[model samples]
Each structure stands twice: as structure tokens, then as C-alpha cells.
Target: MSIVETVTADMKTAMKARDKQTLSVIRMLKAALMNEKVKVNHELTDEEAQAVIAREYKQRKESLDEFQKGNREDLVTETQAELKVVEKYMPKQLSQAEIEKIVATTIAEVGATGTSDFGKVMGAVMPKVKGKADGKLVNQAVKSQLS
Candidate 1:
């Protein structure tokens, strides 16, 4: 099923089960997906729908970091819960080791020898790991490999 349909189905289930948290997250996701659809003026491919979900997941992660830094336990707990709901649709993330390996291989392929080659290495690396790894972690791995 397409993500839009899946979200709609899950929304129904969440409502029937009285799962307020899941319902809320699903509704938010539906809205985000719909907005993207309207913005682009076309039906979203599954990839586009997944991208919207990933963006939501990424936003929550950033918020989680801020909440932790601020020592706001209440908001931290809630954000983490929201992250869990969002994560249900995310592609399985690559491990650090896997990202490093990809960086190493790409660095060699691009002949990126120093930090000066940061953009070169990144340009080559991002696509190989797209949707599979976190961009921050990929950046760290590439920097370490190049420098």
C-alpha cells in the first residue's frame, strides 16, 4: 500500500483502539504529506512520502537534542515518544561502521585526500547512503576519513 493509504488505515485503527498518541502522530503525518502533495501539485511517489516522514523524524531528533541540553525532562520524554511513532515508517538506519565503510570507499573513488575535498567526498557519499544513514553521522565519518 502507498504510505498515504497506510497512514489513513493506521489512523482508523488508532481511533478505534483509543491510541491518542498514535492518532495524533498519524494525523500530523497525514497533514505533512498532504501539504507536500499540494505544494508539488502532483501525487507523491512512495519515495516522496517517505521523505516527508524522514523530515518529521529528523525534526524530532533535533528537538530531542535541544530538550536534552536544556534538561527539560518533560518535553524530552514527550519528544522521544513522538520520535518513536515517527520511526515506525523510517527506513532501517545504517550503523556507524557501515557509514564509515561507505565513506572510505567513496573517498578512494573520488580521490579526496584532505578536508579541501570535503565537498567532493560528500557529493559522492550522500547518494550511496541516502535514506539509509543520518547526514550528521555521514558528515563525521567523511571528515574523519578525509582528514
Candidate 2:
């Protein structure tokens, strides 16, 4: 099934289970997906759906950080719960070691020797690692390999 269909089914399940947190998060995701579809006037492919989920995950991470810094433990807990729900739809994350291996191989493939060639290496690497690895981790791995 498409992501939209899966999400709809999950939403129904959440509602029936009285899982308010999961239901709310799923509704938010649905809205974001719908907005993207409306924006482009086309249904999103699986990749596009993954992109939306990733974006939402990133937002939740930021909120978690901000809440922690502001000493709002309640908000932090809430955001963490929301993040957990959002993550249920994400692709399995790559381990740091796995990411490092790919980054090293990508660097060699692109002949990236120093910081000057960072962009060249990144342009070639990001697509290969997309959705599976976090961008910050990839950037750090690339920097370590290049430096």
C-alpha cells in the first residue's frame, strides 16, 4: 500500500485504540502530506512521503532541543512522544559505522582530498545516503574523511 493508505489505516487504528498521541501525530503527518500534494498538484511518490516524514522528524528534534533548553520538561516529554510516533514511519536509520563506511567510499569515489572538495563529495554522497542516514552525521563523517 501507498504511504497515504498505510497512514490512514494507522490513524483509524490509533483512534480505535484511544492512542491520542499517535493519532495527533498521524493527523499532522497527513496534513503535511496533503499540503505537499496540493502544492504540486500531484500525488507524492514513496520518496516524497519519506521526505515529508523526515522533515517532520527534524522539526520534532528541534522542538525537543528547545524545550530541554528552556527547562520545560513537560514540553520536552511531549515532543519526545511525538517524535517517537513520527519515527514509526521513517526508514530504518543507518548506524554510524555504516554511514562512515559509505562516506569513506564516496569520498574516494569522488577523489575528495581536502575541505576544498567537500561540496563535490557531498553532492555525490547525499543521494546515496538519503533517508537512511542523518545529514549532520554524514557531514561530520565527510569532514573527518576529508580532513
Candidate 3:
């Protein structure tokens, strides 16, 4: 099934199982997806849905970091749980090694010789790596390769 359909089915399952936390996160995801559809005046494709899931996952990660920094273990645990739920809908993340390999190839393809070509290399690589890897990791990999 498509990601959207799977999410809808899971929402029903969460309700049936009386999983409140799971249900809340699923509803939040559905809301985000629906908002995107309304904004674009069309339903989201699988890739677009993946993008939404990735965005949600990123937000949760940020929240988790902030909670940890503030020594709020309770909130950190909560955000981590939410992050796990959000990640279930995203594409399998690429490993750092895999990301590095792709970045290396992209740098060569773009003739990126130094940090000055970072933007050029990133533009060529981001589309290929989007949703497969996190942007910060990809940027670091590109910088290391170019520098």
C-alpha cells in the first residue's frame, strides 16, 4: 500500500488497540499531510508523503535534543517515542558510509574541488539524497569531501 493508505490503516489499528500516544502522533501526521494537500491543491504522491514524514521526524529530533539539553528526561523520553513513531513512515535512512559514497560521487560529478564549490555540489546531491539521508549529515559529508 502507499504510505498514505498505510498511515490511514494504522490510525484505525491504533484506535482499535487503544494506543493513545500512537494515535495522537498518527493524527498529527495525517493533519500535516492534509495541510500539504490543501496548500498544493492536490493529493501528495508517495515521495511527497515521505517528505512530510521526514519533516516530522526532524522536528521530533530537534525537540529531543532540546529536552535533553534542558535535563528534562521525561520530555526527552516522550519526544524519542514520538520520533520512533514518525520514523516508521519514512524511507529507510542511508548509513553514513553510504551517504559519504554518494557525496564523493556527486563532488566528482560536479567538479567540486574546494569548499567554494559546496553549494554547487549540494544542489546536485540534495535531490538524489533527499529523504534517504539527513541534510546536516549530507552537508558534512560534502564538506569533508570538497575540503
Which digits, one per residue and each the tens of the lDDT, describe model 3 over residues 39-70? Answer: 88887999888888888899989988899999
Off by over 4 Å in 3: none
Q: TM-score of the candidate numbered 2? A: 0.97
lDDT of 2: 0.92
RMSD score of candidate 1 (Å): 0.9
Provide the lDDT at 116 for model 3.
93
Candidate 3, after superposition: displacement of residue 13 in Å? 0.3
- Alpha-carbon lDDT, every model: 0.92, 0.92, 0.91
Candidate 2 per-residue lDDT, tens place, 12-109, comes to 99999999889999999999999989997999999999999899999999899999999999999999999988888899999999999998998889
- TM-score-superior candidate, 1 or 2: 2
lDDT tens string, model 1, 1-147?
998898899899999999998899889999999999999999999889999998999999999999999999999999989998888888899999999999999988988889999999999999888888899999999888877
Candidate 2 error regions (>4 Å): none
Stretches of candidate 1 exceeding 4 Å from the true structure: none
